[model samples]
Target: METDFQTVEQAKSNIQALLKGIVGTRTVAIRDALDQVLAADVLSPIHVPAHDNSAMDGYAFNGAAINPAGMTQLALVGTAYAGRKYEGTVKSGECIRIMTGAVMPEGCDTVVVQENVTVQGDQIHFAPGAVKAGDNRRLKGEDLTQGKPALRAGRILRPADLGLLASLGIPEIQVMRKLRVAFFSTGDELRSLGQVLDEGCVYDSNRYTLYGMLTRLRFVDLIDMGVVHDSPESLEAAMNNAADQADVIITSGGVSVGEADFTKDVMQKLGSVNFWKIAMRPGRPMAFGHITNPNTGNAAFLFGLPGNPVAVMVTFYAFVRDALFKLAGANPTAVPLVKAQLASNVRKRPGRTEFQRVRLERQGSTTVAHLTGAQGSGILRSMSESDGIMVLAHDLGDLQAGSEVEVLPFEGLI
Candidate 1:
């Protein structure tokens, strides 16, 4: 009997449960940390700014008590700008007109609003004592204290995070290296790009689509192993080499029960094959396994995706890539997903969940998605033309027009 699987969630959970965090590590510059998960906690090395500074383009006073007579005048001392500090101490009854980001001068407690004073040549009048020391002033390490936890482990690095790290003078950071993924397509019916098509031969869309999708997601590096013939030894040799070279292996087709399908047999012999038939259309025959590196005792995980172009693309986004990232020591969860409105009319038969490729149109505060005219798994047009996929529930047999459904946007991920 074969492994009994029924739902996409079940299959995904089963597959993810088998992955352990990869221990490999590498150092990446702060400029290159975007999208990479931090391996260690980032602590603030010093107080941010390292000194006191002004927040507004106002004046700095000796934090003096305001004296409101008919007119009280404080002498205009000097100007302070960012990166340049005023070294002179403010005298009593005197204020310094400052600019934004200017450093606070010694003996200055509060910044009186420039608008509140009347300037007469080098002298200005304060309305009264109305402020305190360090008002609107940014003290050293105010934004981040010394040794505060600025970033924690397992957090994916983003633009803002990188900026903060740079402000802290961190030039380089330690991150889990990107998981090396080896990709191949298995089918005699497929032909490579830039090659003329022969009778009964179709262009190998899966290999390229998978490659593009992986590239868009910012994978560390992808090895294009290309396509392999259906010979058992040829398939085995390809798998063995990839397992030795890459941390994760992904192949489309050859996992199904057909005369030419030898992927499962080789995967099992090379490692451990955990079989399952997911309860979803277009991606029902996905498989997962791990081939132990005989020399190093480390196992290279393999994800067997469907041969259909749309199926391969959707399943890779939903499944294999997450596991690959996990093997590279990235945060296994929190992958991006989007929701769109159902624009076109599409209906599905009961008993299986359907991932329909749909073109999303933004029309007046709503996103409408239309199913690609052709829905055939082998038809690569829908996958190429559509923006993303609209998911139909497993038990939903028919979805009518104008019915609201959830759609995951392609975003930057192809």
Candidate 2:
């Protein structure tokens, strides 16, 4: 009945080390690559803005013709629009009317914005100090150069990356394959939705929340195996079935030190699973390891999260989230943390880290964090009303009002 305790940092390191192998890769169209991790470096095939072009709709002229101390007037030669070029050369004392994105004409090195110039007949007049040499011009290869790396491997593709690839005339790109994740809740007291709930039983909400969290990742193939009973036969059957189809298996209950729970025994019998008491509040008991499929002998990573609604989310966000990203071939990314002043006093222990749900308020230029109602492991409403979690470190004892602490917002991942 003894528990093996590990600090938060140590547990994270252990979990990451277990999932070091990268997933396989596949080719996908740029449009279909959003949120997928890049498998190889993307090199630009050609220079962006292949020719020197105008960045503004203005007059293009030789910069050397401008008088330094007084106004200068130049005769307008011709007009140039985007996709159209002025074949004639611009000499001193001559200018060409140009539109935005138009290729710079021959011998033109500067552009005076139209608002800064006055036109009378064929003459355009502008102050000498209104424009400078090489003003309002986009040079060739300024945004991206040919044969240079535009995006590195292991980068998660965003919407803008697709546009960047389209700009480079790349229709498709290489990206890591989607991760396969199978999850289920365990407990005889749990029931699926639309089922009549008997005494001492409740409809399972863990699977729904897990589904939402996995769906937001956008690159996970989720297998919702419903709820498994707390019996040796039932738990082992579920694990074997999940291991055959998934790279990772997530279970929401039966990880705590309870006599009725058979998940720990079944996991240990099937693979090299470890049950640990992590030094963290709300999510203390967890099981992590690799489980082998008895049918096919293939192995899959296992994450046994606590049953409490908030604990399941917190443990997944703090540990399993990053591990899955690494296994899916994504570059290491840290969750963004921002410092905020505490609106009230907080009490804590010295040995365990605590994650308190809080609401963020903007008081002038400072961000202030206030607790969201009650801080309980089973309180699902607190998470819904909270903007983020205020992390109280292990070495920290207590915090006074107006003290600053780190908070991880639920912006990028909800």
Best by TM-score: 2
Worst 10 residues of 2 by lDDT: 1-10
TM-score of 2: 0.95
Model 2 lDDT, residue 280, Cα: 94
Q: Pick the candidate with the highest lDDT.
A: 2
Query: What is the C-alpha local distance difference test score of candidate 1?
Result: 0.77
Q: What is the Å distance of residue 96 in model 2 from its true position? A: 0.8
Candidate 1 C-alpha lDDT tens digits along 1-414: 124756887777888788887776679998888888788898999888787878777778766446544456678878888888687778887778888778788877667666766788999775645444557787778789988898988777889999999898999998877778889998888889888899999888888888787886563588999888877888888888888788888899876656354657777878887766777878777778888756556568888888877788778877876676676666655535556666656768777778888888888887788888878877788877887778787788777677888776777442
TM-score of each: 0.86, 0.95
